[model samples]
Target: MTAGSSPRAVVRRYADVTGHAPVMPEWGLGFWQCKLRYWNQRQVEDVVEGFRRRGIPLDVVVVDFFHWPHMGDYRFEDEFWPDPEGMCERLHAQGVKVMVSVWPQVALSSENYDLMRQNNLLIHAEKGEDIAMMCWEPCTFVDVTNPDARRFVWDLCKRNYADKGVDAFWLDEAEPEYGTYDFDNYRYYAGPNVEVGNIYPLEYNKGFYEGQLEAGREGRIVNLTRCAWAGSQRYGALVWSGDVGSSFQDLKAQITCAIHMGMAGIPWFTTDMGGFHDGDIEDPQFKELFIRWSQFSCFLPVMRNHGNRSLSHPHADDPSLAALDAPHERLLKEEGEFKEVVRAQDGSPRFYSGADNEPWSMGKEVEAILVKYITIRNKMRPYLRELFDQAHKDGDPIVRGLFYEFPQDHRAARLSDEYMFGPDILVAPVVQAGARSREVYLPGGEETIWENLSDGQIYHGGAWQTVEAPLDVIPLFARQGKDQGLRKAIQEASA
Candidate 1:
């Protein structure tokens, strides 16, 4: 298993056996913006406009889940999203890429459900009711394992989304997250879910990856999926830890996830910046947690800001959005055998949209902190792009454990809290709540020197140093003399 070598050597060997990541597109490297559900065309446009007005560097804006008439409609709901093409064109004109969400669940009431069901494109329940998930309604997962089924879905996506200037797809439910985990109950065209379920996400991404290639797209395919299998990296699957809660505990867990996911060969990774489940935007404790997490997110391979933030108010002046703060009563009209599309009182498709999560949505102090980190991320794009190129060329990870670089240092081998962002930048994220400073272990003995990126203070390796980590500063150190210009840029940005 490739023993008796450095960690980097072992990872390179692993890449030789499996595969290397594709070169990521330039836009995919910068900051991405998203919330729970940007349900309408107008809301999506407004977020882009907000970023433009504030001059925040935004690479991609995600229109997350339930923009469709139904789960399997594969097209935007006409009533809510009046002009998908024009909206995408407008975003592209602003230099922002659009990522639309697509789920595998085919509801019984969806317009294409009958066609899919008759064509045997849906997953089958061997002995019970054929429903695979009941998350929003009774629905079955698409058997993406089948080539015909893969082509069937990708064709719809190409016509409805890709053709409309949408730049990428968020393959949510790549796990086909079922309402229940009875793996044996379901079967796919490939095999029984329990036996071959691991391949589901691989094929799930392969469908779109192959489709994009067929459409003549080259070196620019990025599918942000929730789950991934072995070799999924080859398909340009940027995996994110899914549906986590908002807590300091959850924040600590992401560091481990990123490091291990990179080790496991998924080079591209991200997380919901403020956690996905519940983050109260106005809570002082949450704002602190969010600031800390946003700092951690700055060094990830893809720096994306997303969450389902709990809000006290809608923040918009529209009276229709007043219902957003209220309980989602699931106002629905029956179709035939199943409950139909989730709707609001005004007969529009309704999914609970969280509070404003824009860079400027938080209070002035938090907003200033966010803006600073975003500026730093934009400035580091060249460095990040080089790291991504390494990943593509050698199967090396963008986020790596200290042991990968300083294997001889016993303390660095034991440390889990700090990691290397490529070979140059060292990131020690503040994972605890209300903590100002933390001890950082700089590896590589006297031969290595680290420059404090924020203030240009210097420190030698193979020692533990307690750094001053204020609210605005994320403890970052540049290795040796590698990023002098970047160091100056960071100091100026902080200044």
Candidate 2:
């Protein structure tokens, strides 16, 4: 994966659905696998209704992968959705844009399979043979590198964008399928000998980005790529850390990882909203963890919830994956028995078996914390909008660290665990559990106001403050003129 190219390189004002540069939100909301179930339609409609009823400002609603009738069929089932355009129009009327997940591979014995085969638009192995890999479907990777292949893919998107009236795309699983565990092995008609495995998402997204560009006015590309390589940022994309497991350690690591990514030149940074793996939020203690995680997540560019729905599973990384292995290994050669060859790939079709990471951890108590922050977030929409404006005008991140705003201060340079949200605010979240107090170092700015909205108490801030938070508070500090209030007019409110 290519790492270094240029940062401040102006890719130009992006063309979008409105024929102008889209004003990216202060942050976004994601309901991962939660939005894809049979009951999801009812749940989604009810939620959308709830938001509409409450006048909640929702910028985007991500519909995750395979919402269509048959998995990998890519057809919007008339049963599930008789009218896709009608759905989009309704959502748009409520000022909500839909960004749905789409995969790059076409499954075996499908129409897309025949299409790729006829055009030779799929990927191939190093030996110039078909390189099939394991995915949910007996899927073969599409050669997004080829011009004709790109055009074909864009055509598919155009149907969704123009005919169906969708808004954006969340390109999922762009990582080229590789490994001995898979069963299928079809050669892709992509760039010659592109052995790069992890770099696939970058290559994969280039088409969507450009296609959206070529789409003229019907679409805007908002790719939530899981596996991104270098130079992936130029496509005007937002990337989340791949399949992060749920754990306090992982939560802390997520913060560090986002900071590292920011330093590496990726401005829009995020991970799974609640940790994607391990821990039971059903337990009161863990529910508190999820609530705390959500409190911190609002500051990120994109907030997404992913992974297993069930909370009863043990917290193991690779516990009892399914028996249906990738078909790449089995499709070729004289493999003895189909049963023996069907080595089930990791996890079930819709479930990640490893760990249990669910929201509603710590239950209503945690919900109270999240709701409080969400209220504050709602209140700060005006100022937050200004930040988003700046991010679009100049490549800047919504949530920055302490040092980024205080580069001159050696103390700020030393504070990696904590960071400044923008130019003024400092956020030092309690990354660990069972912690009454966490250490926070400021840049010794001119003035620091430590305001705990929970208690309506304000503390003077400048140096390190090892405050006793007790797991219910997010330590937020205002550098100086931090009293910016909400800008958007609240027509009708539901407190």
Candidate 3:
């Protein structure tokens, strides 16, 4: 391997060390809708119904964390999600895929915690009071390094979810994120956490991927994980930037994050669209930030929206109120008659629900912008399918930095805000707050011509241009002489 090698060569070297990237499922090519949660079965159905009523394109709908009775039970709480099978059936009927969140932390009171602890299948504390993580309460991470542990958790998921028609999983907490970064204080079946912690996410994804494969499920396996290591891509890990804030700066970081993730060999990537924290749906500034983020999401490998949008009235500090609205209250109740309700440092419930995060939940102006970009994402599915094919066959990135395509253009190597969405299109997202236009550097190579999707204006490569970007548009340019069909699709969507 050579230092400062071409991006293709670097990616190829990565594939040589790891394996080729997994094939992407066709359903994954379209837009996915997610929030902090869809708490109840009715809430899930209503959101899907709202999308259909509004005629917005939705391919996947996620049931985020706390749907289960306990963090480790792997089954829906009957009080809230009374009809898991029927809910899946309804979403499937609408041609939508269902992905439920699965965390790796097993609370002390979890149904299987004793069994795992007795069998040495949970992460151990080297010096503490035997607790490995503290979320709502004391919990331990599953020792994914142990084969038995992986099978144990996977069996629970397969029995509780896969049998119920759930299509995929959102593997949250893949990082096995600890309350503290006390890496030296933990131990795993394979080794001490300090020596093996980095591989935790790899094995986390592996558990589900191997389980799905063993269950006779075939064709591309797509599991959304919060973090990943080098070989995680081969396990079908669609890694996402975790729990980021809802700010313009955070949105800007996501662009570089995805581009670098692709460069690092994880081709499947997404973000918490609009960001995950402190987004007030009613706030004008937040709404503006969301529109810009949503437009940027349209060009990524996976276009999924997620976040904890803030409410007009703050209720997180009120324990009674948070318990009333919390998704995992049943677990709290089960753990010693509500005595185990995990309170934050401030005496509030550890979990807090956000304002409604559906596309229509936002105001009309934001809703229309989201709907337009979503429509554009749907139209680009054909082009995305081709990109996925190339990814599977050649380990190429669907979402790549300009340097990947224009490795010889020294200027393109340093450009982070602009990226090439496959080889045919260059995407320049509006990353700053209150900015209506931005400068874009078109990578120059082989006498290339770039076409602006918004105005059909043509510009030669190897130059920079200040492009106009209003609330509704982020700058999108298609390569002039290649993939004419894709160019037409961009034209129709932009028009």
Winner by lDDT between candidate 3 and candidate 2: 3
Off by over 4 Å in 1: 1-4, 313-349
What would the per-residue lDDT of candidate 1 be over residues 1-495, giving only the tens digit for each residue?
Answer: 654478888888887777778889999888999987676789889989988998888999999988887889898888888899999999999999999889999999999999999998989998978888886678988899999999999999999999999999999999988888899998899889899999999999999999999998879999999999988999999999999999989998898899998888889999999898667777889899889999999889988989877655434664545453345432222221111124555754566566678877789889888888888888888888889999999888999999888888888877878899998889999988878999998999887999887777899988899998988878899886887367766676777
Clashes per prediction? 0, 34, 0
In order, candidate lDDTs are 0.86, 0.56, 0.83
TM-scores of all candidate predictions against the true structure = 0.93, 0.75, 0.91
Indicate which candidate wins on lDDT. Answer: 1
RMSD in angstroms, all models? 4.2, 8.6, 5.2
Better of 2 and 3 by TM-score: 3
Query: Per-residue lDDT for 116-181 in model 3, tens only?
Result: 889998998898588767777788789999999999999999999999999999999888888888
lDDT for residue 71 in candidate 3, whole number 0-100: 76
- The global Cα lDDT (0 to 1) of model 1 is 0.86
Off by over 4 Å in 2: 1-40, 53-57, 69-72, 127-131, 177-199, 217-220, 279-281, 313-363, 445-462, 486-495
What's the C-alpha lDDT at position 325 in model 3? 51
Q: Which stretches of candidate 3 lie over 4 Å from their true place?
A: 1-5, 313-351, 483-495
